[model samples]
Target: MKLGIDRGSLVAWDPDGEEWVVVGEPWNHDLPAFLADGEEAVRKAERTFTNPERVSGRAPSGLPFTPASLRAFALWESHMINGAKGMVAAFGSPGVRRLVRGFEAVTGRVPPPLRPRANYYREPQFYMGNHRSVLPDEAEVAWPSFAQVLDFELELGVVIAREARDCTPAEGLAAIGGFVVMNDWTARDLQWDDTRRGTFGGVVKAKTFAGAMSAVVVTADEVLPRWRELTGRVLVNGEVWAQSSTASPLHDLGAAVAYAARGESVGPGEVLSSGTLPGCCGLEMRRFPRPGDEVRLELELGAGKPVTVTNTLGARPRRATQARHTEVARRK
Candidate 1:
């Protein structure tokens, strides 16, 4: 069953009615309770229905789940290698040499030629994001005041169904509840600035802004049959910017979740994202989106229909007025 939030209420798609039916209480108040209930919560949504509502006039397409935490990983080798090369070029040869020397000194071993990207092959690289910044598909992304270059990453997101710690890949896979098409909006300029300063945590500020996701969540059972055949695409202003098969990633979702749960607890309602797919971002193509441009992401999960999310770029909110306006516009 597909689930979504509608006007602050938990809702499930009523295929027979072709409308969103109120399944439970408002998500903000019911999320914790629902997550604690796990599969029972889904079963309840399936059987229980109150007010049936049509989605025709809804402003922001409500999120399927409000994640307790958002964690994203770089699971594709091509994206990592190309991104590393871009950063190296930006840093210049002298800076790159110093970076390599610093790594060698710390590890007491000669670092590979592509020092940083090589490290990605050792394990899945992930970063925590601001959960509060999650947004619905129709939301407009305000250009961050501190960012001059903005990009969108096409990805698949897994919603955890249960708490997992020090779990194996198979266990991690079993913990997945559902999947969504994710658009990881990024402030490329801020990311570059942070990387140059040797502070990787800058991703929190760069990536936390109004990232978009599909309106409905598809259960694991619905996705498993087509998991290896999923394809992802990114379009900017109606033109295809990048395309890739989800199966092309070097690391799978299970490994990403296992790595994320190593010594750390990943709980239900937390989103684990399959990072930018190969060639799915401007960092690799040297092209970035500008204000007024529309970015769209689609993930074909072979569930008869593809999950899609779209966002329109707006100017940076440098003043309180613009900020409030953006917020109001997002809820339209």
Candidate 2:
């Protein structure tokens, strides 16, 4: 079954009536209660004649559920390679950029992306994302005051339905509750700098500012069988900017969650992302959205209605005083 959270209430879509209907008085207003109640919620929603009250025309403003934690994995090598070139063009020094361009011109073949250690192929490469910062669908995307280049990563996120630990790929896959479209907002310059200068190559301010997920969610039973076959598009200002697909990945969703479960427990409501799809982000496409631009992400999850999330970029914040480290005078 598909569901959305509207003002902390669970709302299900009515395909026949072409409207949204309150699923039920969910125990807690989100996935936990819905998951806990299982088919009972669907059964209640099905009793339309008995409980017939259409929801307001206003769209849902919240994610189907609040994720307990967010974990994103780099699963597409195509995106990595193309994104490497974009990083160089956008952040590399002029001389370095020219040299790479010259080399490509001379060789007539693009070099491999300057990313990923050999171990990338050995296991799933992932990082912990800030769940607390996730904005609901249609929320204005606040511009990061410290960043000049704002970007977006088109991805598919999986919701965990139950606790898992030391599970195999199959078991990990079984723990999935549903799927949602995700926008992993990024600060290109900050991310580059943090990964290069911070301790252990951190991704702090670069990634944690804010992220977003579609309010709509399709249940595991409906999306799992064809999740990989899903197709998507990225639109800026209502114009299609890029197309993406989930036909290929270095590792499957099962492996990603399984890797996370190793030596630790992954609980219900936690989210796992299928990293940026190839050519789906501004970084890879070499185009950034301006302030007030509307960025939309659409994914066909094959459950009758397609999942989409849209947000407008907010204006950049005013400049502020620069921060500097304190210095101590040298002693003779």
Candidate 3:
């Protein structure tokens, strides 16, 4: 029989149902009952997260994870040095709670307060930073500038479940919290301007920025075929302009993880967002989010509630990069 969601009475209300239910974590705890022996070890706190079920009613119809979940895994892993399965053993038993208590007593922060709900945080944006470059999609937040090629990229984000340093690709998949739709806004004008001038890795300023990411998390909660087709749209003033999908993403989770691991250690809760699709930005269409204009970004996760984002474009938007290459070249 389906185990009535009993995460040690450590459960949250289904935002949709308003009924107390077990908050699904990244993992499907179908192991043995012994794993939950230390069920009492779990505590309640403010947090966010959900599976990919599109049943909408009261709560926001998206999967938002709490930072607390990551902390819990960290503490458990420390004790279970052997691996996480051992952690399940520790929790199922009664003494597990005492052990967690002792650990908490030493380090005073409460165990699992809940992960912070990240707001529009990413490495890219409508207006790229530093140069104040103009990204392809409509800019919700004004930046420096956008006079050149307006562009956007289609990318993917790896929602993480736990954090681990020096992890491998296999570990990355095992530790991922979940998968969420991500868009790294960009500033094409700034890129074009900077390209003719000098170095430009600072593109991050124009690319990932807070609130740039759409928080529609898709965990393994719902039944999904191998690849799900979804529509991505960036609109300005009620016009359906930019269009793309998760299928258009150039990089996948596994590749990004392997590449990331080559350089630095990975952590839990970190998102590896896909950059941007090929033709979904202004650079290709030659449009940008001007001030006073309303920008609506919506992702149609077919048969699922589309993830929508609407922000008013700021007038006198910020400039990303104002490089007078011709004047400088002429002067020299």
Candidate 4:
């Protein structure tokens, strides 16, 4: 849990191992995973992400994998529900090592995870539908060819604490795993085009680039007041472009998840984001991410003051020369 790689590092221990090992769940588990060493249990798992082919084959007609699905998976992982492969209930949660354990302690079973880590999830464990902001694939030092109007979100995301089959707002908050910061970057002009047409896919196009919803992510171990007294700020090019607090959320994490689960299932690793807090680029009237711009999102985690993540938007490398060099390197 030391701050070697990211926040409180998470690891999985086995029967024969002498110690714990670093690991990430199925999706965005990069921060700590980079440092996990030894222990094949987590290490081997570290590379089992779903591939493009698998992702394509698994897309169901109704589109499962949303807050409700995540909650359901959490129960099974915690041993709260029936544990059976192929059953949605048996899914696992992914994140840094500590997050999994913290969640298991509350839920009783280890939720399923994609492990070690893969690209920002091409298919979320749960469906976001149309109710939230866009969480991207990664952030950039410069906006690439496909990227435009880059922006960051200051958010608090959580996993379900207990089984929330059909819960209300109050009941939902009580079942939280804890909160972590999230930044949902956006492609403004692209998003605007999609929004006007009422298209789901285009709205998601905002999520296609380096989508690491974080400049940084912290667990309660690193945050303050556990889950309250939270405030936030966004720095753009060394200036305070936006500022907010936990109270700025349209709804707390639990509320968002609960709403996501009303007719659905909420499970572990089913990311329930606060969408975009006030002041982020997506909500701005005229300002948004520009090339070479540095963006930062800062917030309070448990016990820690405030951690900030700074990102720079840069242009994509030219394909003619750079792409040829990369191709040559691959051949060699």
Output the number of the lDDT-best candidate. Answer: 2
Sort order, TM-score high to low: 2, 1, 3, 4
lDDT of 4 by residue, 151-245 (tens): 55565555443456667877665545434455555554454445335456334665544333432333323332345456778777787776755
What is residue 62's positional error in candidate 1, in angstroms?
Answer: 2.1
Evaluated at residue 302, the lDDT of candidate 2 is 50
Candidate 1 at residue 193, lDDT? 60
Whole-model alpha-carbon lDDT for candidate 1: 0.71
- By lDDT: ranked, best first: 2, 1, 4, 3
Number of the top candidate by TM-score? 2
Worst 10 residues of 4 by lDDT: 55-64
Could you tell me every candidate's TM-score relative to the true structure? Answer: 0.77, 0.88, 0.52, 0.51
User: Between the candidate structures 2 and 4, which one is better when assessed by lDDT?
Assistant: 2
Give a tens-digit lDDT track for model 1, residues 214-254: 88776776685577678878888899888887676677778
Candidate 2 is scored at a TM of: 0.88
Name the better of 1 and 4 by TM-score. 1
Off by over 4 Å in 4: 1-144, 161-163, 208-210, 214-229, 248-252, 282-285, 316-332
